[model samples]
Target: MRKARGCFIFFMIIIVIAAVIIFYFIGSNDRKIASDDSVKINYSEELASYKDNGIDYLFLGIDERENENKFEGRTDTMIIMHIGNNGKNALISIPRDTRVELEGHGINKINAAYVYGGVNMVVDEIYELTDIKIDKVMLANFSAFIKLVDALGGVTITVAEPLHDDKSGSDFDPGTHNFTGEQALAFSRCRATAKGDFDRMDRQKYLLAELFRQKANFSIIPQIPDILKILNEDTKSNFKTFDYIKVAFKMMINRDDFILLTLPGESATIDNVSYVIVDPDEAKIFLNENLG
Candidate 1:
């Protein structure tokens, strides 16, 4: 009986030690993505009046190049992910060249908001434009984008037309292709289409939808650690590790209900600069009709 008790006590101690080690590693990994210097933005007071029936996240794809500060750059892609309580989720893309009035910079492209004041300015501008209160924000650089696509074993997408853009390094004949990280980036960045930036936004939205479908499967469970490591190195988010896990689970369960949309607008040249002129009221109505 004494020997049994001794053995049981030893087993309990071992279990405790293992748990401590597991938690330590988890905390370490969480800290890697949670930078102390992350920018904090306060949503407008008007957002208080808005009822929150679900969670909204703003994802900014920064256009940072090699050897540049990852957090400082023009936002190449702006997407708002709204997860509704009714099991419907939507990914809405906001054009980088959409015109908006900045606090100090007068009227300019929406992407410039990131350059002028980082995530805070961008979030505020988005709120003003759409009146959608964002619950969290995630900023990812080019490195993160490439690595993530690569880690997922690449994504398969169908190209409707031939693309040949020297600037974005895209050269492909029209067909379906399994895109590598670099190729996917180029595809999203290509502006050689007849619609120019609008076409780019459409491609971006399609790519994101494909990524979601691929990632929401159970087969990617083993690759989560590597994926999280890549995100840790190049992505900054206000979400915790558990928060991500929960969202992933939700996405996996609700993958069938996922949808993609882009803000409605027309391209116009104003003051010798091209911009996507989107009406705020129309944008709100569009989101409500589609997202709800």
Candidate 2:
């Protein structure tokens, strides 16, 4: 009887080991590009670098008010967050106005890549500009951003002015305030101020930073289902369920190690049409320093 019990335990251990191996391979396979997808473009393989710091992922917040599935719009926000390996520290936020050249397309506004093609085109554009390969992407719509903020128990924002807008139905005095779905969306999208797009980007970045600040609490775990639902209902990604799980685990583990930088450039008008031009030399130096 003792021998039989020991054998049974040994068999269970073997099964557990096999299960773990299967999980890892299955998860890894899901993240790979599917041959049938139209966006699957040929590119050289990029090896994962096991390092002390972490990896940088291009976080694109697209304004998909038009074609949601095909990922069409001017990427209103582009953030390259370098999430460290241990999941404890991070720097966030990169402005979309940064000028860069897209792969197969000549120099143009950094945000134009999305309008020109889709996530794949934008990914290729960033890869060409930074010379750093991205392992994965999180493609989110503006509405999803609002839902994420609300899922985190709503985000607090400080208003600098009182404004009335019928489109968003918002009018708030200058002070510290908490915002919900539509309010938070309007707050982040506010361009009524004098600074226009620059001010709007700054506000959006600030709001997002605040969200990240509160996301690390243990209490937020229970809200993940709602968050996932928001992502499912509003956002679109190439990742599978397991792939998202693995990435989420990695993020939770190494939430702290992150360095965020925006592409440095200015907006201009060529033949009366606004264009964000890439300052080649300055951009090269910036990429070499930060991305390295």
**Candidate maximizing lDDT:** 1
> What is the clash tally of candidate 1?
0
Candidate 2 Cα outliers beyond 4 Å, as residue runs: 1-53, 68-70, 84-107, 160-170, 240-260, 287-292
Q: Which residue runs of candidate 1 sit more than 4 Å off their true CA positions?
A: 1-25, 29-37
In the order shown, what is each candidate's alpha-carbon RMSD?
A: 5.9, 8.0
- Candidate 2 residue lDDT tens string, 1-292: 9999999898777667655655654454354435226334334454233232455556677777766553567887776655544543334344466556666777667788877766667666666655545555677777787778888889778887885666545677889988887788887776677755666666666666666555755567557556656665566555566656665665555554434445565667775656555565666578556544
Error of 1 at 96 (Å): 0.8
Report the error of model 2 at residue 147, Å: 2.4
* Cα-based TM-score, every candidate: 0.87, 0.70
- Give lDDT tens digits, candidate 1, residues 26-84: 68657764555464555567665677658888889888863378777888889888898
Query: Model 2: how far is 171 from its true place, Å?
Result: 3.7
Q: Model 2 residue 158 lDDT?
A: 82
